[model samples]
Target chain A: MHLERLDFRLQLRALIRKELQQILRDRQLIFLLFAMPILQLFIYGFALSPEVDRLRLGIVDHAGSSISRALAASLVVNGVFEVEESGGTEAQLARKVQDGQLDAGLIIPADLERRYRSGQKTRVQVLIDGVDANTAGIASGYVGQILAAFNRQLTTGTQLPGELVAPQITFAYNPGLISSWFFVPGVIALVLNLVSTLVSSAALVREKDSGTLEQLLMTPVSSLQILLAKIVPLSFLLMITVFVALMVAFLVFHVPFRGNLLLFLFVSFLAILVGISIGIALAAYSENQRQSLLTSFFVNLPVIQLSGAIAPLESMPEIFQWMSLLNPLRYYVSCVRAIILKGVGLEEIWPNVLALAAYALILLSLSSSRFRKQLK
Target chain B: MRRVFSQVTKEIAQFRRDRLTLALAFFLPFVALLLYGYATRLESKNIPVAVKSYDTGTLSRAYIDTLFATNQLVPARFRGSDIMGPLDEGEAKAAIIIPAQFSREVAQGRVADIQVVIDASDVNNARVIKNCVIAAGNYFARSRDIARGRQLIVPQVRLWFNPGRDEALYVAPGAIAVILWIFPCLLAALAMSREKEQGTILQLYVSSITSFELVLGKALAYTLIALAQAVLLIAASMALFGLRLVGDPFMFVLSLVVFLASSVLFGTFAGTRASTQSAAVQLVATTGFTTALLLSGFLYPLRNITYPLSLISNILPARYFVEECRNAFVRGADFASQLYIPLALSSCALFLYLVTSNILRKMQLKG
Candidate 1:
């Protein structure tokens, strides 16, 4: 009996060692796995952004008054805005904004001269498409701020000649618009999902590919125990890798070290388990390494979509909101954010802990059952 | 259990020479974190425009000159006399006219008017222009009235959540999920794809292994890896970005489980359909990426889109993830309120498992 246990351990260890060798041997995969994420991070920092700047501007003035002309000049002269188009009907202008051809349009009424002469405030409507709330919202705000400044100019009227107008305004979190701060942390969350899943999924599947899975199965070991052993090494290895990644993210990216590391570690511990179990389950399910990788990719979409990493959760319909509950990434993001930003303890993040643990349980239990069924 | 250990050792021994497999297992997380951190963002930039000013006086000159000075547009140079010509020729956004009498009228305390002609070709750009104008004009008028001793003018405006109007502020929170979601899912989906490419899938099927076992094994292995990577990524993010999470971590993890399931299901399901590993990877990755970005309410919110289109967003998992993450991290909502998301996800996972297992079983026999 003791000899049997020793033999079992020997076999399991051998498999782990073999698995490690296979991964290390694939230089292309290692490069792809690591290089791809870093490249993507750079792209994200450079390209995809909600910030709208340098809008094409169009102006139409009918008053023919010196005042009308002067005003048009001031509108575009502001560094914050740019002059693009100059002539068209309101209907025609509306069509331009509708077609996605232009970002902003300006109309100076024909009676613009009359409004100023009669001293009656001319009401000019600024229209905006609410489709892209982010861009639309920003454009609208910029226009408002600039206009408020202009109001001050007009208050010192030509006739009245000497009063300043100022509007009350306030700025919120990330007042300076530092894109790095916003993206660095987000990238940390995104990168881990790819790294952990990719590596873990390939491990067990490789065993099956190498003609070792059946050999292991033939042994007298229970399927569940075999599965548990399979997860142990990979789990241990991944935990260390994650720590390295985190260290890189901090040391290399200089992202921000505001949150409590202890809270983060606790959450990381639970989240890592869930991720590892998912990988194990995939390995158990896959007949080949290719299948395991492909399976992981196929599942990427729904996870990202339901997680609210890119879009507003409330903005999405209620149904989709319910669907996202399954994405472990959402919870990871939440936990990461809490640890990084709030530096909260387990009590504060317990809900996330429980959720991650539950997810790990589900993945582990199901995979184990599947393994048992496979054994049968 | 003793036999199991022996088997594990044997499995480990059979592949000691394969270094590629081991390298990916531990090093992939850092790579993924760095890539996703840099790839995602809103695509919008530099618009071109032409300007024509009709006004000759100081005020009109000030206005038209201001238009040219705006950085958002690439300004076209023109004389005041050519205002209409530039506009008609489609060379300018709008031609501004300042009556020869503009300055005198304002000095005399009379209402002075200005007309702006806009090109309606680009609807959105036109609106942006209009917004800029009304805003600029109101400012000019407010102070002008005070100087002339005319009726005081006060305009009341209402603002929403982002008073500073920073678009990134709103995007920052959402981007966390939008960019991060792809990791677990894409990784899970790819795991099986890679195994198929390596010719390992066939060997696993010949054994007495059930489809459920196969799927579970794949899912668990990948999940473990994903969790580790997530930890590192999270740590990196917190250390570098200072992004705070005010909500429950449990809720966040719960959401991730659903995301992983959907990602793997697609891969597993796609594998059943595709004949080759490359084909599976291409098909699954494309579908996953497109669906999440376009339909999952990431770039565009359902509420802002057409109702019918919004309805389509319902079937997408990203939609819920976005909301749930926001609720979990931002609002700190309780587990009960969040229960609905997990319930829906679990059901989906179950459905995927059933379908995948059935198909795999069929494929195992036929292939």
Candidate 2:
């Protein structure tokens, strides 16, 4: 029995060494494993911001008065809108908007200053391009807020007999609202998900495609040991990627790692296992690498979408929100976000931890069974 | 010409034989469409906010009522005096604490301070929460002022193009652009890399067909497949999202053809560059798919993308194609006004085809 155990270890070690050598020899795989995550981290951290700013505003100041100019000036003061072209007719501004050169246009009427001074309610027309419904909504809201502030300034020192409620808003966790802090954790989850599934499945599918799996199966080594040999090395490599990604998030993006280090790694490992299991299942089902990749894409896209990695779960419909409950990545993202951002421990995120663990356990067993069947 | 035609036929035959890939090409986009249409809502709605009212008075209750009245925030249950507990536990995104003024300060015409603590982990969602809560506060204050008779400058705002602000109108076209770019590029890249991997490109090298003919043949075949994908996706979008062509159909059709050709050529370029199918897939995913999704102004506006990255978007064909798709579907502007979009798309197609053919010609020479 001791000799059999020794033999098993020798075989597993050999398989792992072979896998590592193959991975190192493939420059593209090495790049995909290490470099892609950091590159994606930088791109997503810097470029992907939902905070709307610097909209191109076309001004048609027909009034040509100080108040009208002051109104347009106020919109530009906050850097929300930059006056691309000023002192044009409303028709000209509309044409610019139609041509997609401008995001919105503010038309100041000829009597705007006159009407305001005479205490008659003045109306200004703000035309917004609503093709991007999100930006357009935010722009209109911003215009409303600016106009409200302007109105408050105009109506200041006037005697009004009413109560005022002041809401003192304080942003916790991330006071500065650094978008990268929000995205980096999510991107880390996304990169890990993509790499784990694609690399693991491709590794297995390549073996199957080249008829090497059959060669390996003819050996005395158990299929379980073979699968373990494959999974262990891949997981070790993926964990290193996680470390690299986390370092980038910390050093470059300044994303705070507020929770327990061990807990975070454990959860991340669970998430990676979930990804690998799904990949192995896909590899076992697919006959070739091409089909494996296409199938992985088919699986990965919805997983990423429903994970609340890119878009928030609160924003999704009720059905999708409930559906996200079934997504393992959702639990991972929630845990990661809580740990990194909110500085919560396992106590706070135990449910997510449990869910992730369950997924890892269930998927690992299922995929291993399928893999063993395929080997036989 | 006959060589190119025969090559096209050969590719289509292989593609048809791969029933799995053929089904996925049609089905995956439909899944993406459904997900993008329903799942990708940037607008934060029904954010859970834990409201801790220390004052059980009428005014505080009314203030709480006013907060939830907009339906942007809903009350979340939290235990004890720990205001941050719910937020920390991920049960609520924000917490509202009403101090024990007993409505005395507000009744006395003083500003009643309500402390609002928000989880700004998601900066975008936090911004929405802050805006919603402040708006609710402002409304409450303004209504009181209005009770005493006061009016300010009321700006009449008009939402042009998409007045209803339907999200599907914006998302469906962008989804089409993204789906079209990713799948076709992926398919073509795989096709090219498969030949290289299987050592079949040597046959092409020995054949009388010129490098240009081989590239064109492959591109034409994939372009036809991509065209079918476009038709199916467009038809699906219309059926699913109730989308109709609002602008010049001819401009839309022209841009779609140009965009598909560019995407397919791009795939072939990556395939030719990468030695392995995995490498090609990686190339397409990292460059083609991510850029098409992010920098193409599919989810975020182009203006919102910061500098340096914005420069990358300028060269991306997907960006221009998405613009044209949105124009055709939502804005419905005059064809003349949006003429530069198709021009830019066609230029991109021409550039990609030229670069791909150059790569193929060099490969042929080396062989």
Candidate 3:
């Protein structure tokens, strides 16, 4: 028994050493493992503030009056839209739109000042490209509302001003609509995937590269032992990577962690293991590095959509939502967001935990079988 | 003409024998559609909500009852809890905290504001729930006043963009980007991987097929495919949806050319690096499919990330394509000109080609 235990320990240690040597040897693997994540974190966190502001607009004031210029000035003062150039003809504004030089344009018709003086209703045409419907929609409506509100204040009509005014709009949750809240959690899930999915495939490719894979088969190490040895070390490395990532998110990105740290760790562990196992299983059949990377893409591409990381599951048509159930990342990401951001405990997050655990066990076992079969 | 025809026929026969290629070519679009349809919907309906009622009085009870009557909540998954559990688990989007003094405040004709604690993790979901919560509150106010024979609440002007919300104009340009990313990868994946399979890729070094020639030939093939796919996709989208060609098609195609050039160049790099068909497929999915969808600011905006990472998105050809396509097709951007996305994409294509050539020259036959 003592000899067997020692033998097992030696095998496990040897397998881990082999995996590490292969990963460290390759410069590309090093970049994928370390540089990519760090670069993305810094680049995405600092530079990419999705808070939509500073829209560039081209304006053509047909009347060329003080009122229109004053209106344009209010838009700039609000910091919502910037007038890149002050004066442009109607055709020039049209040209700007065509040239992609402008996000929007304001064309004040010939009689804007006259219309305001006559106390008559005037319609301002806001032309927008329907492509990128969301941005266009938001910009056009915001400009329209702001201008109309300015108009409303000036013209107190037959209907009382207060009556025409709607109840004040209060955006809850993210009142300012900070896009980071949407991106950060999704990125955390994705970055974790980089560790499990990307690394597992690379690790398998490394074994294939170094020729230790066939050598291991020549030895008496159980396929399951080899699989566990390969996974546990990588999982440890990934856990450290994930922890560091979370910390960066916490400190630098200001991504809040409201739940139990230990529970979060446990849940993330299960999720990462499942991803690694799936990658390992896929990697087992690959004959070369190219094949393994291809496996990673085919497997990982579907996961992004299937995981409810972007789309709300319920909103998806029934066939698609059912398809989402197969995505283990969906459960893991849900659990991560719940625990880390929302501070939900095991009681609420248990469903995801159970699903993830099941996934991990199934995937690891399947990968072990594939490894055994491949070796044979 | 006959020799060229026979060569083309031979290529066709070669393609027919490779079941993987056939299967992928046929099934990829269907797969993409299903994936996009299921994965990318931003709309949130049937948002789950948990209601904790501390209100037992008639007015408060009426409000609670009206809340249940609202459309936004999926159903009460949990009965009552303080702010944490349900929202934390995403079991409920909003927790309506109806306080004990609720009826008394209403009877006194004073404004009683019940706090609605929402899980703000999902901004869009939270927005929908907030709308529902407001509506429920308004319903309570209207009902309470109606009982006393008073007109308490009235509808008001909500200045929305385009006046009427149009969904068609929104999805067209993204489709153009999607086509640009996929078509080139398919054609380029085949060209490089095929050469590797046939042992002819090595002949580039033997013969004088410059690295530029290889990239250009492979890219030219895929560019044709991307162009064809663009026409079909654009025509189809416009036909299915009333997507008018408000902008210049020429500008759209020009931007697409830049996008495809970059994507095809990437495929060449990927195909060369890959030792097998599966790896080529995987590389496309990872670099082409995944990055194009997410990092390119297509499905989600690049601005959502921190600076330098979002800048990395600039290298993603689809980012430029999405921007330029949206400008031309939906925004009615002039076809004759537009510089930014095209310039960026051309630079990226040039860079990728240079890297492809450099790497190709240094290519090792074995990994």
**Per-residue lDDT for A188 in model 3?**
70
Which lDDT tens digits does candidate 1 get at residues A121-141? 775455554334456555665
TM-score of the second chain of model 1 compared to its true counterpart? 0.71
- Top candidate when judged by DockQ against the true structure: 2
lDDT per residue for candidate 3 within A1-376, as digits (tens), equals 9999999989889878877776678666565556555545654445334344566777777777887777667667777677777246767766665565665677667787787787554555555533344455445545644554455345445233222102233333345555555556666777677657777877776677669787878789987777777788788877777777787777776776778999988988987888788778767877765556544545766787677665556656567778878888888888877776667689877888999899889988888787778767
The TM-score obtained for chain B by all candidates, in the order given, is: 0.71, 0.95, 0.75
Candidate 2, residues B1-367: lDDT per residue as tens digits?
A: 9999999999999888877678667888889999998889887778899988889788888888889998878988874458788888888999988999938877776778888889998888888888787777777777655633244567788998889888788888999999999989888998999899888998898778888899999999999999999999999899989888988899999999989999999999999998878678888999998888889999878876778888999889899989988888877777898888889888888898889888888878553
By TM-score, how accurate is candidate 2? 0.96
Q: Which scores higher on DockQ, 2 or 3? A: 2
The DockQ score of candidate 3 comes to 0.24
Which consecutive 10 residues in model 2 chain B have the weakest lDDT in total? B144-153
User: By DockQ thresholds, what CAPRI class is model 2?
Assistant: medium
Estimate, for each residue in B44-121, the C-alpha lDDT of model 3 and write its tens digit: 556776766577888876776776674546666664345555655566676666677778877765667676777666
* Model with the higher lDDT, candidate 1 or 3: 3
- Quote the lDDT for A2 in model 2: 100
lDDT of candidate 3 at residue A100, scale 0 to 100:
59
Deviation from native of the Cα of residue B319 in model 3, angstroms: 3.0
lDDT of 2 by residue, A1-376 (tens): 9999999999999999999888778776688789999999988887788877888999888799988888988898998898898437877788788767888898888898778888887778898899888778777878877887777776776654333777788899999998889889999999999889988888888899999998998889899988998899999999999999999999998988888999999999999999999989999999988778878888899999999888888889999999999899999998889998889888888989999999999999999899999788
Superior by lDDT: candidate 1 or candidate 2: 2
Best by TM-score: 2
Q: Candidate 2: which stretches are off by over 4 Å?
A: A159-163, B147-149, B365-367
